[model samples]
Target: MGQMRLDTDPIVQVDRKPKCCFFFFSPKIQANRIVRAQLWVHLRPTEEATTVFLQISRLTPVTDGGRHIRIRSLKIDVNAGATSWQSIDVKQVLAVWLRQPETNWGIEINAFDAKGNDLAVTSVEAGEDGLLPFMEVKISEGPKRIRRDSGLDCDENSSESRCCRYPLTVDFEDFGWDWIIAPKRYKANYCSGECDFMHLQKYPHTHLVNKANPRGTAGPCCTPTKMSPINMLYFNGKEQIIYGKIPSMVVDRCGCS
Candidate 1:
């Protein structure tokens, strides 16, 4: 059995706006010796109706290898006036444990209101050397919209407005990774006949119009159509590009599922 070192101790806090806490580990311990790991979170209730939510996963470098670290076990608990800290165990068998490449490890914890509105988020990392390093990520209050140029206008006589377009871009820096758009239309939306939603279907493509909704379908009045392809370039310690059709037709959705 290998030794486990905790870089940060568990603590509790209360916030009106809701924020997640973080703990970080140092990279001084042996990597291969670690057979399994676990995290214990102590949630101290500040209000009568307070509730807490949590999530744990591994974070790998983009350039290292396209491998996902398997978490053997995950536990969740909700308690009223609970004094003890909740324990989350992450363990794996030999083949499952060794399948993942040796890299930095990270876990993400989230809390939400009764209505499912995000209240807080916390993150912790375990380095290859067995040192646990942590960083806290604060969630924004609401949805954010980003725009970029989509060059697909055919009206050369309609002034510069005919040639200018805007596309959306999202940055996942809070998760310690970054990706960019690629030319592909894995999803689709309804728009004027002149708008070429299909052009964005291929790689190295861009949006054609600014007002055009990439999610617009031609059927119902407000039904969500398909979406454009988004090239994801992951930036861990190095740059890794994933060029493929998104599994689903939704936009801005994350996670392997």
Candidate 2:
């Protein structure tokens, strides 16, 4: 129905050697409209990336570890302004994801050169039209499903009498922001250093863990200097989203049981 923007840090030279950005989005299907399945956005590369890997994946639950399955990917040589505005063809993947219930999906933007590693940072600003990442979708009419189906229009251009429905839908996010986290643990890994392996502040690892061997317990962490209650309260960083009520334990491992 509208656009959703997700932003990250501005610093490219993080404490970690390689700068990796993990972005997540959950698209919920609408009642009557058909999804066009395309994502358009502007990607600003802070530096030249001789070779880059842009991967889109889904997180699936596992017994011991949490991991993401690669759904779509791209490798290319990037110039600073060459790919500012690009369109990703996601028709096939969007259709598949829409069929399932709320699923975890993400974009991993990693850049490097033929010789080896490279550096880059996404331009994330605080306001709309800032460097924050965003996406847009188009909707058309469907067959069999009618106007009364989900109270939304499948085809804005059509006034058809008969419509159809199959279970195709998407959601940007579903509930689960009710609970709050103490600022201490969050500030500890403010830059998200090596803490991607643990569940802190009663929350799952904010990053997508390795599917083959997701770390089971919390590890020693360091809080950031900006640990304040007010700062933590207004922070809109979304790590994990739960479909129903907050789970008993911070998402016991990353994949579905």
Candidate 3:
């Protein structure tokens, strides 16, 4: 998804203003994906020049009804003695945090002076009114994965011959893939169109085009199903590779007789 503004107008600011939604898994992000969360804050120097630490911390809900504990924090160091609006990448500090669904997020800051006297920054409630602060979040989907030397993944190139694909398999949902196709001989294995379910007939074994033009390059060999070069469609609606046309059949009703 595109960048989105979370809490805007009610720009809550305080010596300790923490966004609560961040404490938990973000609804914007999906599982196993990468996302960036940002905070836009307008701050002014409440004390002498000092180092400000912007900490991204979280609280986890105890499963055993125990006390909630604080996890390691992601911190961003900044010099904020001067008044200015800064956009901070909370994700840069808290990268890899999206992997967990257990923690809730909040933002906290601490000001440290060279003399060791800790100071506090302007709170959201100060109502000084230079500008309110807000947070923005961006979520993105990750790329598809390819597994090799596994039970299922193979050396099959994608239908577009652009990338390698998983190999052919007989066991629809149970068994693993049989073998991988050679990368050198990679070929496009696009399926045919949608099956003509309304024309559910017996196993025609009708390679009409192939029979008409045996030597031509336009025939059954052109359409390959999830299994092999010969596409298959089933009478009982268990058809495969229905690519917007008549699908193949596999009921064993007539064994090519």
Q: Rank the candidates by lDDT, best first.
A: 3, 2, 1
> What overall lDDT, based on C-alpha atoms, would model 2 receive against the true structure?
0.36
| Poorly placed runs, candidate 2 (over 4 Å) | 1-35, 40-49, 62-64, 80-83, 105-129, 142-257
The sequence of per-residue lDDT tens digits that candidate 1 reaches over residues 59-97 is 344454423444433333455544333445543322233
Against the correct fold, how does model 3 do in TM-score?
0.34
Over 88-158, each residue of candidate 3 has an lDDT whose tens digit, in order, gives 56664344455544433344433334544433332444445324444555556455354442112224343
Q: How far does residue 208 in candidate 1 sit from its true spot (Å)?
A: 99
Off by over 4 Å in 1: 1-3, 8-36, 49-52, 60-77, 81-84, 93-102, 111-113, 117-257
Better of 2 and 3 by TM-score: 2
Write down the TM-score of every candidate: 0.28, 0.36, 0.34
Query: Model 1 lDDT vs. the true structure?
Result: 0.34
Task: For candidate 2, report its TM-score.
Answer: 0.36
